[model samples]
Target chain A: MTAASATVLITHPTGLHARPAVKLTKLAKTFEAAIRLRPDGQEGWIDAKSIVKVMGLKLRSGSRLELAAEGVDAPDAVAQLRALVERNFDENV
Target chain B: MTADTVGIVIVSHSPKVAEGAADMVRAMVGDGVRVACCGGNPAGGLGTDAARILAAIEEVWSPQGVAVLVDLGGAEMNAEMAIEMLDEGRGAQVRVCNAPIVEGAVVAATEASAGSSLDAVCAAAEELCQ
Candidate 1:
């Protein structure tokens, strides 16, 4: 199985709140890859596709997160998620 | 009015609570689900109004049906009464779900956005109880 990963900074002023968490979960569900995310130095990763889990992370602005995906579409999943974070989840930074 | 997308209504004694919950659901589901909020009494006090609840149900009514989430107590009774006030055929299309308002609305909206049936939406919302 292919694996891909990226470390992204949370740029949204409010961080990974409910709205962005929902957007991330929705995007994660569109891929076949097993997506997981954790704080840059966190011990364990949580399923990125679960809104509840993602929101529970309570990532704050400027927090660094590591997004990892493993599967046939791992590379694409990682790239898309990275872009989403870089874009500030399409919300005003 | 999508054939398979069930709508949702949130009922609470406080208008702010109902509207805020609806906002949260909309944030999760985007524009894909129909969500309405009905709160406060006819006198504009902190109580659930059956007429207001009925109007909310109608506002989001779809052939697929609607699920009502109430914030406990008289809110549930008002929701049920609102459903009963509808024509028999239409009333049968609505359900007063025994679920927490905020969490239930979020779950129900997400499920309905996926084109789930009324029963499926209610079941999804009810899962929050577990």
Candidate 2:
């Protein structure tokens, strides 16, 4: 199985709030990877595909995040999730 | 609405509240699962109605099962009444979740869109109550 990881910054004004968290989880579900995330300084990881877990993180704007994935599509999953965070989940309008 | 994904219903005393919760579900989940709302009495004021709730359930009926999120005790009671009014087999596929209405519905809808089972979707919504 392939593995991939990324470090990203939450740049959205509200960080990973409801809409962004939902989008992130939904996008993660499209992948065949088992993905997990942790805040830059946090101790444990949360499932990247679980809306409840993603929202529970309460990640705020400017928070740095660490993501890891393992599976056939791990590399693509990590890359896309990193881009989503960078694009602020496309909320800038 | 995929037959493999669970359905969702939002029940609230106020029409706006139920619709608002349903809107949140739509915004979050993008309609992968069927969702319906029942709010206010037949007169359209702020109140719960079993008949209206029943119609909402049927509106989003899916053999995959449905998980209902209610805003208040009356809404929950009316949802229960609506379920009881259903044929026994169909009623067996529904559950009234005990959780905060908006958040619960949003999370439950996401789980449903993820193709979670009926019981899993209900549990996802109820988890917020703890």
Clashing pairs in 2: none
Tens-digit lDDT track for model 2 on B13-51?
999998998988887778687999988888868899999
Find the candidate with the highest TM-score and give its number.
2
lDDT of 1 by residue, B58-99 (tens): 888899999999997999988888888998679999998778
In the range A27-87, model 1's lDDT, one tens digit per residue, is 8877899999999998999988665577679999999999999999999999999999899
Per-model TM-score, in order, reads 0.75, 0.93
User: Which structure among the candidates has the greatest DockQ?
Assistant: 2
Clashes of each: 0, 0
